[model samples]
Target chain A: MTDAPDRPADAETGTDLPAGPADSDAETDPRTDGGLPAMDGAVPTRDPGAFSQLATALGRPLVVGTVLVTVVFLILPVLATFAASFAHEWAGVLPTFVRDGEFLTLVNWRQALGLTQTDLGAQRGLGGFWTVFGVPIPVTIGFSMLLALGGVVINLLVGVPIAYAVTRYDFYGRGWLNTFAVLPVVPGIILGVAFLKTYSDLPSAVGLMIGYSLLKAPYMVLAVQSSFESMDLRQLEESARSLGASWPRTFLTVVVPNAKTGIVAGAIVCWTLAAAEFNFSYIVYSSGPKPFSLFLFENISNNPFLQAAAAISVYFAIVVVVTALLQAVGQRGFALGGVR
Target chain B: MSTLDEGPLVARLRTGTEALLSPTTETDRERRRIAALALPFVALAVFGAVVPLVVMFRISVAEEYLTATAGVQFDAWVTLLASILAFVPGVGSAVDADPVYGEVIWNSLWFGAVTTVASVALGIVIAHALEKYDLPGEGLLVTLISFPISLPGIVAAFMMIVWFGKTGLLTNVFVWLGGEASLFPAVTSNEVKLTGRPSGTTIAVFGLFLGYLYSMVPRATFLLRGAYAEVNTDAEAAARALGATPWQTFRYVTLPQIRPGIVGAVILTFRTALAIFGTVLVLKALSVVTFRFDQILKVGYDLPTASALAGLFFFFTVGFTFLSLRFTSAEVTG
Candidate 1:
């Protein structure tokens, strides 16, 4: 426990070394053991020994096969959806005309986006583009983005202070504060229903924004606190104080910038999740402007195959892009990323 | 005698108070003040999240609303006790001939267990492989595997249908290969037919399973990968140097160190599967408690019953959450 202070630094430098080589140096001197090759480094040199050569030949295929199988399993659904999003017709598990030139078509895209003619003559709103809600598919997309953005802003405002205080200060009930932040995230579906029932009187949009921020802020707090805890906060603060900057100014200018990676990563995760949230949005926002998720849910059941695919593809694109950005920024401690 | 005794005691207390109240440093005072900044967030979380859940619990016990189909039951406790006892093999099934709540609970437990075991096992294997071996395209593989974590449950469920529904790509492939046309499970219950459960097919359950696995496996992998990365390879190497087999080294040296991560992944997957709603609804599976709770409110128009069901669900969820916090010392979100 006393060595905890030095561990993180050690970890930072120690990540690249394989366990085998490090162990060989300590207890069992690998060179003295039956002339067997030592697993000294990560990459094996082209050793002339038969055993070394055989080990490489045997291990290579196993690694490749495992990676290949895992990748395929993870990617199969996305590939299937991406393919179905464009195909005009389905023949069993595949498109009807993939073997020929007509395998690809834009009809589904057109119909889904409300660019095509509406099948209902009297209810003709350009292929479900215009609905009773007086909004188009594009509008819903915009609404979803706005809602997500609003949630991100609200969460950051609530999360940053808590993160700062808990990480940098010693205070009463600080432990409880951390737990409080996390409580909202535990029972997602139940909370959604609970919010609906509890705040039935509050206007739909206002209630949803509150619910979303409550749900999303914890992820931010957790991430930002981690970034703050890992930082050399006292040293930085002392330097800023010696330079005559006020504590608030130092926190705003120095502390926040240092934690920017975690903040950005947490925001991306929060925004994407808020945009894609369906249960709360479905239950709570039923009366007001429906988000893209609800719109997709409504259309998926009865809409033309092409239209459903197109709408889903658009939403999918948004979430994937934002999520990809999150991965890029902080794959270590961002999206359900490690706590410590 | 009384005055002298009181005066000395008061003087001693005053000195102690003075010593305690004196400021240590300017920065310490600043930090103490700054710590109050967390108060508002605490208040907001309490009011927004905690209060609502508490109200749900209150509604469960309170005889609040009376519906035409099902009247208000102060007997929520009775129902809860009955439901719990229903977990026994044959005794509970005889209590409720409809077998609705019992079957739903049974299905939820089974699905949660299956999903937890499968995802955790896959996570351990893949995370170990990624951490230990230098695989080609490692970056892309990690990204792809973890991609579904960000996807909405509804979208994942929609993707499942797109891939495996009646006219789905996989279904068509099965046909092309001269096999059965659908990969979906057959439904046995008629009450949820409108929810799109095919007769004799558990497709709804299967769809929900896919949605859970699609996201949970990646999440598990992400978590376990970190655990694997943090593992002290020195110990494993030491064990290996002593001529222990690879499996022995893993079981003795590696597994114990990563036990918390393994527990974290299992609990997260299980709890997420338990709380899953949008995916189950989109896929039309009503066996899970979340969907059933929602349905009781919306379709049955029985708020009290719904509240009771939610309360019971929360009971199970809270138990799992306690386990999760104990294991990982953090709250996990789906």
Candidate 2:
């Protein structure tokens, strides 16, 4: 910033410079633009199609060695688990896992689908009980579905009012409101637990719904703000007041449609997280109704049953599949789109 | 008819609430309001999550918290040796008693660190590859990679149990393909077999990594994809126009740009792995209590000691998370 080029310019385009330092202190100075040097633009090149050279550097001893060691040391067990889901009767050899297959049986998938457990301490789950009437799939998966649905439903209600306040009017604590909403969503079991303790002894199911909304509402509000931010306020109110429409009607017709995608995508993220949840479910529902993940936990603890495992797998598979389908249909571009 | 259009009442009511919004108020009033709103939520979170931990910590340090077997005593720390001696008779009883706590914590931390480091690195590579496979089953592959996220940890654990366990498909397939002698679980004699134990912290960590990675990779890929878009393509072209190696251009340009994304994803994954309970409990069945809470409680609950430990655990978790999130968010947002 000491350089003439980086120093403040006329209030024209905000950043109208060609983006370089003044030519004076080139040799001794490190930073050319802000803290980053402008010489970063220049790189001496070698061959055409030299993209392979980057790949070659990736193969350097440090990179290759670290990657291999990580895979062997860290990822191998995960790989083992993924394969074990298809297993049955192999537990003796694979003592670490609940089920080990002596011979491949579709039984894990079957029992997971709500068939009777040959072993102890397992139950039917949401994936298995799927139908039009909606039979309750027992255990972790079912509980998760309920939590996810509850999160979405509650957020839709919570988000609309907050969105309206930010969008239609200049509201109180608008800046800090934005921060307070988002500040909770990051993973921390301690803070969340602390929040719930004040409202304890009620149903944990209620806690799950409320907690998820509290965490997700900020993200939803942030997303909704984008649509609210980009709006032209004059046309919206002028037309409404002129045509004898109320403030609510004008918002419903003009505002909501434009912001619909952001809200939907935000809601999806909120609910998906609820469905794919863990820590709270484990801690909150210590004696309450177990969710799909918790039920899955019971399966592993009681000794693995292929049917039970498969049932749980199918439930989640269905969720992911549905999400992907929705994502595909919703928007084609914008990688950071509200789909979250 | 026009009289029904009275907006005064509604406007007044709305204004009533909005009046509390202040440009200038006593500092204490604002602080009090903030605390009031925050305190309730904070209290709720504690009762639900921290109470059990509080109970654990109190007993660890106190006279007694649990109303179960044994007297109102606070000598559980000393008796930790006695339990170890009973469980596994001691070559060196008092010194390394309750080694499960040490072993499990080590296993958890090492596994978490390695997996996070690995995933961030591989996710970048795989994401780059997937951008244009121009091949078949791309959708399925992407979905499969993300399977662990939506899928629960227990389910993943069970899956690993079946697939990598001694009689699992891979092992069975290996044996079926006539590699039994070289394959795992070879039964030379009735008494001599090669099946491995399915319950251990190692596999549990493995299960955790899968679940964490499946959730993390998509986000990381998204971040990197954005990072990749931000790359000055013209600079690369200029570099190619000169005599720079691709490695040189990437080292000098691409990697520096993507550093923030990589760090953020790594932090997210590490936190997720550390706090995981489902996989560890299910896989090991809580037989191996890793940290101080589980270990001390397994020893009789000395109220004051347990409370101190719980406070430490709570503080440690909060401090670690807050610091990491601060660093990662700053790195990215800045």
User: Cα lDDT of all candidates, in order?
Assistant: 0.67, 0.50
Q: In model 2, which runs have C-alpha deviations exceeding 4 angstroms?
A: A1-144, A159-200, A214-254, A286-288, A328-340, B1-109, B131-144, B176-216, B285-334
Candidate 1's TM-score: 0.78
User: For all the predictions, what are the DockQ values?
Assistant: 0.30, 0.14
Candidate 2 Cα lDDT to native:
0.50
Residue-level lDDT of model 2, residues B33-63, one tens digit each, is 4443344434533543455455544454455
Error of 1 at B206 (Å): 4.3
Which candidate should be chosen as best, given TM-score against the real structure?
A: 1
Tens-digit lDDT track for model 1 on A1-340?
1011122225333343334656556534645656766544333221113333343445446545765776675577676666677876765545654545665777677666655556352123222333437655545666677788888888888888888887777666776666666544546667766775688778777777777888778678877876887898889988998999987788889988999987988888788778877777776665655676777786676676656777778766776677667767855322355321
Docking class of 2: incorrect
What is the TM-score of each predicted model, taking all chains together?
0.78, 0.62
